[model samples]
Target: MTSKPFNKFRIMMKSLMVCTALLGTTFLAKAQTWHFGPKFDANYSTMKGEGIKNKFSPGFQIGGFAEYNITKHLAIQPELLYSWNSYKKSDDFLTYYVNSGRSAAGNNVNLGTVSVPLLLRYNINNFLSVLAGPQYSYKIYDDEDLIKEGKEAFKNSEVSANFGFQVNLSNVGFYARFNKGLNNINDIDDRYEWKSSHIQVGIAVRIK
Candidate 1:
């Protein structure tokens, strides 16, 4: 079960990467002003669900982005980012696991995802821009010790929306964004729905 699902996910991600590369190449060939750079952010993230606590855990996202200017005030930026997220569940909700011979594991769910967001950026000034976009993510990192994959506890993919404001100064950039999950990630029988969200603050260094 795990083998087939993991293989399919890997193949899909590879295809997505190919498509993104091809699109970026086409944009470059069109004589567009493209800025490529590295980005890294520290995030406060958590999940919302019936049994989950409304608590945030510290994590980070690190990746690169390509910004293509469409006009003086408009641009499109596509980014490939990897997110590491963690959250805690209610102790009452986790007691069941303790009774069932599984370790409580601090009721923590730690996972990692690869996300791609194509943002439409609107420049408000020489030093500021606001961006919003739809994002697709695949869960490639999992803690098997806490959540066994053989049981298929969570969905492998997620769809989300991202909106944010960025400040730019020369080659260095700073931004804050809200990432809201649009689909329920609960895969173990939908009696209760679970979704994730994050607040991210980061810096980007563009190569001119």
Candidate 2:
């Protein structure tokens, strides 16, 4: 079970790296105005599905981004990030687990993933911008000590949509974004579909 997902994740990561390298190299060669930076985020995440009754769980991410200015008010931003997301199961969910002949270790699920986001940013002014984009993510690690595999757990890869706003002053930037998963992540006999969603708040500092 884990082997299949791990293989899929490796393939996806390789493909994404190729794409990122091409895009970044092209922009670096031709674009005169560019900003590259490190970013850190705090995320509040949850799952929505038939059996989920828990609230949001806190997580975080750290990574880097490159912003290429296409015009005075329009820019393209691409990011490579390592993200962590988590959730707590409801009492009903735990009961269901135990009733299914599986021992309930705990109620928490933690997932670590590598994500790539391609964003189109529209600058309203020098100080503000609005961004929207698509993101691809591949799972890297998971905490299965509690919520084991085959227990309505998530899959290897996910696609999501993001929309956000950014405030920038000099070399400092602050952003908040909402991400909604576009595909089902459930793997428990396919009886119910689960989708992940989160709110990410982060700070970015330009270094180049």
Candidate 3:
């Protein structure tokens, strides 16, 4: 009985060792072929007007993304981002001072929002890919120099659609994305419907 038990123990140990070796090999293969990374972004923004032309303005965004490989031809990317989107307008100094009782030449309105995007990427080659997805955004802050005037507060939430492309290098990637707001950035009683749109470019580094 003792001899039989010893033989069984020996067989179990060998099986365990083989399983461990296989698992280690699989882990190494996955590590060598795939990676995930963090991303950072900068943006140029402008409002899209239905009947008016709006000028382009400067903006920025920062974010991180997890990239997963399905094959040499495809991948999935999901990201969480904080973006600043705004436009600027100049006012006459004498008119502004006389009307608003504030001694200022010109003023600017700045709007800030946070967004999350999930994208599906189709790789055209090792160097290029195209991405498209839906983005959800919330307005966190908006500052206006003429708020002391009778202007109401700015809107607070936004929903948008996102589309873009990615360029991949040895251990880094670059991307450009465009976002269009689906909802108004202002309330119903506001004079104009504040439509938001932006273009973002970013760099990414692979860590895993």
The lDDT leader among the candidates is 2
Looking at model 1, the pairs that clash are none
Off by over 4 Å in 2: 1-33, 94-101, 145-152
Model 3 alpha-carbon miss at residue 156, Å: 1.7
What is residue 88's positional error in candidate 2, in angstroms? 1.2
Tell me how many residue pairs clash in candidate 3: 1
lDDT of candidate 2 over 87-117, digit per residue (tens)? 7666566544454423654566778788899
lDDT of each: 0.77, 0.78, 0.64
Higher-TM-score candidate of 1 and 3: 1
Looking at model 1, residue 30 earns an lDDT score of 56
Sort by lDDT, best first: 2, 1, 3
The sequence of per-residue lDDT tens digits that candidate 3 reaches over residues 1-208 is 1224465345435534443454345446765654555567787777654322266678776555666788878887766666666575434323423443344412455665656787888999889989998888766555554433545334677788889888989879898988888887654234457677788888988767
